[model samples]
Target chain A: MSAHLTEIIVFSVLFLLVSGMGFVAAKWRAPTDMAHLDEWGLGGRSFGGWITWFLVGGDLYTAYTFVAVPALIFGAGAAGFFAVPYTVVIYPLFFLILVRLWSVSHRHGFVTPADFVRTRYDSPTLALLIAITGIVATMPYIALQLIGIEAVLKTMGVTGDSAIARHLPIIIAFAILAAYTYQSGLRAPALIAFVKDTLIYIVIIVAVIYLPYKLGGWGAIFEAADKKFQASPAPGDGIILNANNQVQYFTLALGSALALFLYPHSITGVLASRNRDVIKRNMSALPAYSFLLGLIALLGYMAIAAGVKPLPGAKPGSVDSNTVVPLLFDLHFPPWFAGVAFAAIGIGALVPAAIMSIAAANLFTRNIYKEYLRKDATPAQEAGVAKITSLVVKIGAVAFIVFLDPQFSIDLQLIGGVIILQTGPSVILGLYGRWLHRGALIAGWAAGMGLAFWMLWQIPNAATGRKHFGGSAFALSEFGFDTPKTIYVGFVAVLVNLAVAVLVTFLLRALKTPEGVDGTAKDDYFADEGDPRIARRLPGTVEKVSST
Target chain B: MAEPESPHADTKPRTDSSPWNWLLLVPIVVPLLTPLFNHDEPRLAGFPLFYWLQFAFILLGVVTTTLVYRMTRSRGRS
Candidate 1:
């Protein structure tokens, strides 16, 4: 497919418009004070219904989910739609956990989950572990957003041949992203999300209707996809799941739902909402995106039906599967509309990249920098540190993409889901009851982290031909039992984590080891904006208490 | 459920919130109990049971959450 000049022009204009919005977002909210983490990091905690809706939508549905989800479906038929049930389950999961996190964070002036983890369990070591995990897990996700942008750029013919030249566009994109995020913080992404979501919805709706018409119909689309998969020699790559992959499909969905909220970026978005009601409303409404995702996944089949392939002169097997949707658009739609869709994918990457970097930065500033490095750091110092850290995190993500194969970043994201899921047993469980002993939690987290890494390290990919860290699925025989099946690594790791946590809890109880002081009151978990208990702090104030 | 006696501070005798709170977990649990309905027999409108059923369950989850949110609306947050 040829990249038309009109497509290039339209994509540039729309992207420039988004960049302008990102820069202008610094003054949009106009916080009276910019010298506090509350303003710079959390957007003054003042986003209302509409803003929070767009923000959370943009935050969760990243370029990775947009480009990568459809790409995965295009590459590996039904299993890639594992994202569907996961997305469906995640809203309900967020519906239950986020409101409580919002309420408690408001009550105790908590900014990050690590902060809550620090206070709830009163173990800086455990909090340190959680904070480090958040930062580490978020790095690959930011790399994923870069992968999204790179794919769009490649399809646009904007890429250069050499390594440095090929990545120059990504570097430039991320530089603008870093600059705007440094100036406006979370508000930058929140403002641009309105445009991103609208473009994505428009593109998806049009594609779902127009493309299927061009390629006969949905029946024909699925038939073509089934025929293509049937021609392939791979096992478990079809329009439907079989007995072998059913276990993997189910476990991946369940584990991902459990892990989605554990990421600091997701929690950061939730905490930025004006109140608990925003969180509640968004949870119910976010499922609308799941329906959209389902439609997007079908684009894979549409591409098959339309017989769309990579660009004319590209080498065989050199085609990045991520370009399927973009190429499909380039082949089917007019140049201008294809540009609009490319901008949506590009901006989709930008919004989540900003949020993920910001969240990672928040974790570093609050948990590591202030807690350990400078107990007496001022509010301005904290925000300053966070701002610088966000840039550094972006730089790290850039290095991850530029140095390693982008496929490794994808595998790392699978490993990240496994890593992040381990935090659920502590963060989610700690929100309700403080039953697990602190020592036990340490053991649990260790076991979970270790098992997740080990399990991911054991799995191999047939497509990539890597022995370890290949993808999210692992053999059941890793436990020395022969079963002709694979399961989500996160699910098994979490089970191991939970088992160790429970066992250690019992051992600690028998040994009379203290489960540190619960810094928060029982009522604090449920406190809302109007509640007398959660005194509304002024916008720019750091914690009044020394502990934070 | 065995409530392990916690010898920690701030034991304020927790009040039972509502039975509906447990219903929030239904959506999360539905996928795990896949043995109940993992087959592809009953296709809905040319979509396999394995596929469309997930969408149905997702709608069911959304409805369940909306119900719980409405019932506990006053209690959750104003």
Candidate 2:
């Protein structure tokens, strides 16, 4: 820590600045009352185009964008670029669908996706299942963000020989994050998103332009990357996709794109918007971050061109590939600038972690606590429970890093996408209509999750030497095919989920199984801001005025 | 039977569904068809076809969504 004083100081200053902003963000919007879920968990649901743009962008792109994508590109070649296509398609795919969600959520006072599920289907059991799945899926994702900050810390020589010393920085960082999120709720990340995005854009733009100029041109970088892959023994390592992995690339891209907005954090960001137009306008605007992300993915190849090696892992002889991007900046840029870059990655982790915890907490509060634990809990009590749950969620994420191997978190994130995608037939499909019966939706979810786990159990990561739950790209040969071509696990699982849903819906209809009440109307999906129907039900306005 | 809520007794005709929503499919489908642009030839500034084409897809997505937003904005309220 003493050797790299400049980087540490610079990183510390920017980090402390954001930490200050996080604490002060409690008053940024100065909500009329913070005791309501609308204010505490959803930023008062008044975010307009610009704030929604930054908040959602910050929530989605994450440290995964800055650290993980480039690391994957460095390790796997063109396969890593799947994130580009995944993000490129996410906006257009979710553009119209999200507006319907926005309009309805505002109209119904829904705080979590499970809240919407509960009200839409009128089934507390199904809503509880959705809420549990969301919390389980989100825990690993929050853990992944810690790995991002740890990668940056390791690069700056902040790591130590002992396990406690090595993980101390991450714990302290998350403590600050948990504290501010507990105090400020969703607004902490919303306010700090502005600073996080500005720093990231500056860092990424400079790294792309200046690094390429310094280490030969873009042509030279690609040439060096191609040359390295040619001699590499790994089948997936190439400057372009090959036959064996092309299907995996396409399916992974499509599957991830579909799953992107389904995450509770993503919905948290969306539901916090002011209205439908904010979501619509943001669908067009958010892809600007994808352009930056594509450039960031290329930093992997740039790391190869510069011959930047990853730092040693906690285990002997293993390398932490997530450090590639940080090491690239540390090797090329001056200490002060590198510190800024590290701060960008570190804070990048915080915004999503905060949003994800808030999202998970909201799920617990609205769906679990309100539905089962305390049916008559007041809005203030719900807010208090959510705040406490947010702290526990953050602590759970920290324990995930401290007690378990970080590799487990990575595997859980891969499984997280598959788990969250199961909610599609219930949540996403439920938004359009209620043709699928509630019993069928539950059966479909069970089938999807079971098949996804069984499939994931077969994949073995040769690099990590993990036998089961190794990775997401399951081979086609598992079905007795005579080929090495593989497909994404989630993609295959979701198709089965939808198929099972349709089949079960028909069978259940034939059996005359009763369907539950859908509390929403068709026009509810189309209602926008200032709609009399929506304005009347919005939480803070109606309930507060009536009580007063 | 789960009837419509009393608040929605005055149901308006559904005019918000637009054909322009189908245009959004262009961005989603074109990007997934990797066979069209997955190649090493036609490099742009040293970016292989695969790399540069994805950047183009981002632009395509933005343009298509923006177009749909403009066209569908008025229809929803009417």
Once fitted onto the true fold, the runs of candidate 1 whose alpha carbons sit more than 4 angstroms away are A1-3, A310-318, A540-548, B1-16, B31-46, B75-78
Model 1: lDDT to the true structure: 0.82
Residues A290-325 of candidate 1 have per-residue lDDT tens digits of: 888887887877888888784422233545677778
* Per-residue alpha-carbon lDDT of candidate 2 for residues A51-107, written as tens digits (9 for 90 to 100): 999999999998888888898889889998999889988898678687788877877
- Give me the candidate number with maximum TM-score: 2
Per residue, candidate 1 scores C-alpha lDDT tens digits across B6-67 of 32335343322667878877887785555655655676655666567777777877788788
What local lDDT score does residue A234 receive in model 1, on the 0 to 100 scale?
88
Considering only chain B, report the TM-score of model 1: 0.66
lDDT of each: 0.82, 0.88
Tell me the TM-score that candidate 1 gets on chain A alone: 0.96
Residue runs of model 2 more than 4 Å from their true location after superposition: A408-410, A535-548, B1-5
In TM-score terms, candidate 1 sits at: 0.94
Among these predictions, the greatest lDDT belongs to: 2
Query: After best superposition, candidate 2 residue B28: deviation in angstroms?
Result: 0.2
Top DockQ prediction, candidate number: 2
Alpha carbon deviation, residue A111, candidate 2 (Å): 1.0
lDDT of 2 at A303: 98
